[model samples]
Target chain A: MLELKNVSAGYGESSVLKGVSTTFEKGKLTSIIGKNGCGKSTLLKSILGILPLSSGKVVVDGNNLHSMSRNEIAKKVAYLAQGKSTPDMTVEQMVLHGRFPHLSYPRRYQEADREIARKAMGVVGIYHLADKPLFTLSGGTRQNAYIAMALAQDTDYILLDEPTTYLDIAHQRELMNLLVKLANRGKGIITVMHDLPLAFNFSNTVAVIQNGTVVAHAEPSEICGSSVLDEVFGVKIERLPNDKFYYDY
Target chain B: MRCYMKSLPKNKIANIYGIAILLLILSAVLGVLLGASGISLTDMLSSLVKGDIESPEVKILLYVRLPRILSGLICGAALAVSGAVVQGVLANKLASPSIIGVNAGAGLAVILCSAFGMIGGWSLSAFAFIGAFLTVMLVSIAAKKWGASRGTVILMGVALNALLGAISDTVITFNPDVSVMSNDFKIGDFSSVTYAELIPAAVIVLITFLVLITLSNELDVLTLGDENAKGLGMNTSLMRVVFLLMSALLAGAAVSVCGLLSFVGLLVPHAVRRMAVTESKHLIPLCALFGAGFVAVCDTLARVVFAPYELPVGIIMAFLGAPFFIFILIRGKGGHRNA
Candidate 1:
C-alpha cells in the first residue's frame, strides 16, 4: 500500500497540498476526483517525487519513500504525468526506455528487455505502431505509447495524473479498462480523473479531494451518491430520472 | 509497391547515400591538388599511385596539401558532431559551441597560456582542451543553479562567449607577440599544420567521434524530454553530464586544431535534420560526414579561389555559412518557436 501522512506542498510561495493524508491500497483502482485547482495533480506530483513535499512522510510497503533514491523509487513506482508528450522515438524505443532503472552502468538491452517492451506495447494496444515515430502518431496513440513505456518498467505501484485528458472517448475507455486489468492483476493503480462516471463505475474506491484535503475516501458506490458529489464538487445536486445526479452550470 | 516504397524513408536514405559518396570522392580528390604551389590534378594523382616525386610541385602536394586537408576534414567532422550533440541535448537548433561559450572558453584558455609564454603548437592545443572543459563546467553549473531550461542555458552561453571574448581581446592587445598570434589563431589557416603534428589532433577527433556515435541513440531518447527519459529508467542527470563532457571535448579539439570556424557547427546539424527525419543513429553519422566534407570543400575553395594569396578557411566558411544562416533566420521569421 502507498500512504501519505500530513503532506503539504506548494509551487514556490503559495501552498497547494495542505496537510493532506491518504492511503491507497494495493490491488485496487483508486480514483482521485475533485474540482479544478483542488491539489489533485499536486498530490500525484508529490507521490512521484516531482513536487517536493514541504513536510510529510510517504511510505510504500513499509519503506519510507523519501529515503529511497530516485532510481530505487522509480523501480517500485511508475508515474505517468498529464500533458506528457512522446519524443521523436518509435514505440518500441519508447517502451524500452522504462528498462533504464533495471540496467547497471554501461547498460545494454538483452533479449528479455525486448520481450518485456514487446509485451508492454502489446498491453497498451500499441504493438503494431512499435515502428512508428511518436511525433507522427495521433494524440490518443501517443498517450498509449507513454503508458506503455510506464508499464514496461514493471513497477508495483502505477500513479497516473489525468491519463485520459487528450484521448478520445474510445481511447479513454480503453485506457480505463487497461487500468482495471492492471489492478485485477495485483498492481496498485491510482489515477486522478475528471470523468465522474468512469471514476464511479470503473474504480474500486473514490477519493474526493477538496480545498487541498482528501475529505472523503470510500467505496465508489458509497461516495458517488448526490450528497457526497455536491459536497466535493461545490454544486447543488439534482437527481434526474436516469438515477444520476445533474448539476447546473 | 512503388507508392508504398516511396512513402517509406527511401528519399531520405537515398539523399544521404548520394551525398555521402559525393562528399567522400570530392574530399579525396580536392585534398590532393589544392595547395600554395598547386600541383596539376594529373600529377597529384600520378604521385599518389607511382610514389614518384618527379615534379617539384608533387613534393609540396604530398606533404602540405595532404596534412592540411586532413586537418580540415577532421576538425569539420569534430565540430559538426559536437554541434549535433549539443543541439540534441538542449533540443534547440540555435545551440552550438560557437554560440554557447565552448569555443570561447577554449580560446580564452589558449590566450591565457600564450600570455604566460607557454605558447607552442601542441601545448596551445592542450590549453584549448582545458579551456573548453572549463567553459562547459561553468555552463553546467549555471544551468543547474538557474534552471537548466533550454533558453536560459543558451542565454548563459551567449553571455559567457561575450565575457571570454572580451578577456581574449584584452590579452591579445597587451601581448608582445600579438600580431602573429592573433593572425594565426583568428582566421584559422591550415598552412601551419605538418603531417606529423596533425596526428594527435586527428586521433582525438576520431576517438571522440566514435564515442559520440555510440551515444546517439541515448540522445534521441533525450530529445523526447526529461520526464519521459527518466520514466524509461535512464539516469537523466548522468546522461546530461556525459553528453556535455563529450560535446566539450569535440568543440575543444576542433578549436585547438583549426581555430574558430563558425557555421559548420550550427548549420550542418540543422541541414541534416531538415533533409531527414531519423533517430540520432542515422543523424549523428550524417552530421559527422557532412561537417568534415563541408569544411574540406570550404578550405579547398579558400586555398584555390584567390589562389596563392589564399584566404583563411575560417573566412571562406564565414562567407559560405553567413548567407545560409541569414536565410534560416529570415525564413524562420515568427514561425516555429526556437527549441
Candidate 2:
C-alpha cells in the first residue's frame, strides 16, 4: 500500500497540491479524475518523488518515501508518463530498461534480466516487436510498448498519467481492459483519467479532485450516491446495460 | 554480449568497424605522405617500420608527420564522441560541441593560458576542460531555467560563440605575444602541434572514451527523456552532469591539441545516426573510429590541395558539413527530439 499523508507540493512560486492526501491499495485499479490543471498529474509526480514535498509525508508499505533512495522507490513502483518521446530505441531495448533499478553499479543487462524483459514484452503483446523502433509503430502499439516497459519493471504498483489522452476510443477501452487484467493479477494500478464514463465504470475506486484537493474518495458505486460528482463536474453518472456507464451533463 | 539489434546486427557492426579501421589506416598513410615534399609510401613505410631516424626525411616522418597524425586520430575521436554524447544528453539532433559553444569555450581558455604563459600541456588541457565544462553547464542551466526551445538553445550557443571569440581577440590584442596561437587557433590547424600538447590531450581523450563506453547504455536511457529516466530509477540530474562533464573533457582535450577543428563533432555523429546506428555502445565506438579517420582524410586533403600553402582542415569540414546540415534540416530530419 502507498499512502500520501497531508502532502503539499508545488512549482517554484505557486502551490499546485495543497494538503493532498490519499491511499492506494494493492490488487486494485484506482482512477483520479479532475478538470484540466486540477493537480491530478502533480499528485502523481509528488508520489514518485519527482516533486519535492513542501510538508507532510509519502509512506509506501510502512517506509517513508522521503528517506528512500530512487532505486528503492523504483523497485516498488513503476510509472508510465504521458507525451513520451519517440526515441530511436527498439521495443526490446525500451522494455529492457525496466530492469534498471535491479542492476548494480557499472550496470549491464544480464541474461536473467533479458528473460524478465521478454516475459514483460509478452505480457503486453509486443513480443514480436522486439526489434522494431517505437517511432515506426502506431500510437496504440507504442503505448503498449511503454506499458510493456512498465511491466518489465515488475513493481507492485504502476502509476499512469493521462495515458489515454491520445488514443482512439477502441484503444482507450483496450488499455483500460488491460489495466483491469493487471489489477486482477494482483498489481496495484493507479491512473489519472480524463474520460468520466470510463473512469467511473472501469475503476474499482474513483477519487475526484477539485482545485488541487480531492473532494471525494469512494468506491465507484458510492460515487453516484454522493452529490460530489454533480457539485464538481456538473454531471450525473448513469449506469448502462452490460456493466457500462454514461455521463449526462 | 551476443544480443542482436535490428539492421545493425553484431556482424554488421563488426563490418562497419572493419571499414572504419581500414579508413583510418589509409588516411594515416595519406597524412604521412601528403606534405609539401611528398614522401613515397615505400620510403615512409621503411622509415616507420625500420625505426630509422637519422635522415632528415625520416626525422620529418618521426617528428612532424607522426605527431600530427596522432593528433588527428586521438583528438578527432574525442571531438566526434563529444558531439554524439552532447546530442544524446540534450535530446536535440542539432546539439554538437561546436554548435553549443563547447569548442569556443575551450579555445578561449587556450588563449588565456597562452597569454598567461601557461604553455604546459597539462595546465592548458586542465584550463580547457574547466572552460568547456563551465560553458556547457551554463548553456544547460539556462535552457532548463527558461525551458528553452531547441532553436533558443542554438541561438544561445551562437551568442556565446561570438562573445567568447571577441574575448579571445581582445586578449590577443593586449598580449601580442600570444597572437601566434590566436591566428592559427581560429582556423584550427595541426601543423604546429607538438608532443608536449599532444600527449596530455590524448591521455584525457582515451580515458574519457573508455569511461563513456562503459556508461553508454545509461546514456541511451537518458535520451529517453527525464521523466521516464527518473521513473526507471536513474538520478537524472546527476547522470546528466556526469555525461556533460565527459563531453566537456572530450571537446576540451580536442581543442587543447587541435585548436577547434570545426564540424567534425557535428558531422560525424550526424552521419553515424543516418546509418541507423543509435545504440550508444555501437554509436560511441563507431564515431570514434569514423571520426579519427574522417579528420585524417580531411587534414590530408588540406595539405595536398594547396601543397605548400595549406588551408586549415576546418575549411574542408565547413564545405562538407554546412551543405549536409542544411540538407538534413530541410528534409525535416534535423535530429530533433522526434528521434
lDDT of 1 by residue, B243-293 (tens): 888888888777767776677889888777665445676777888888888
Interface RMSD of every predicted model, in angstroms: 6.1, 3.4
**Tens-digit lDDT track for model 2 on B1-339?**
323323325676677888989999999988887788777777877776777778667888879888988998888899999999998888887888998999999999988998888775799999999999999999999998899987889899999999998898898877889853655677777878899999999999999999999998799999777998998889999999999999999999989888978888888888887666778988999999999998888787877888888888888768766787678656745555453
Runs in model 2 lying further than 4 Å from the true structure: B1-8, B44-51, B180-183, B323-339
Q: Least accurate stretch of 10 residues (summed lDDT) in model 1 chain B?
A: B1-10
lDDT measured at residue A132 in model 2 versus the true structure, 0 to 100: 84
Q: All predictions: root-mean-square deviation over Cα?
A: 4.9, 2.8
Q: What is the TM-score of chain A alone in each candidate?
A: 0.91, 0.97
lDDT of all the models against the reference?
0.77, 0.87
Assign candidate 2 its CAPRI class.
Answer: medium
- Which residue pairs in candidate 1 collide? A97-B232, A98-B232, A101-B233, B92-B339
lDDT of 2: 0.87
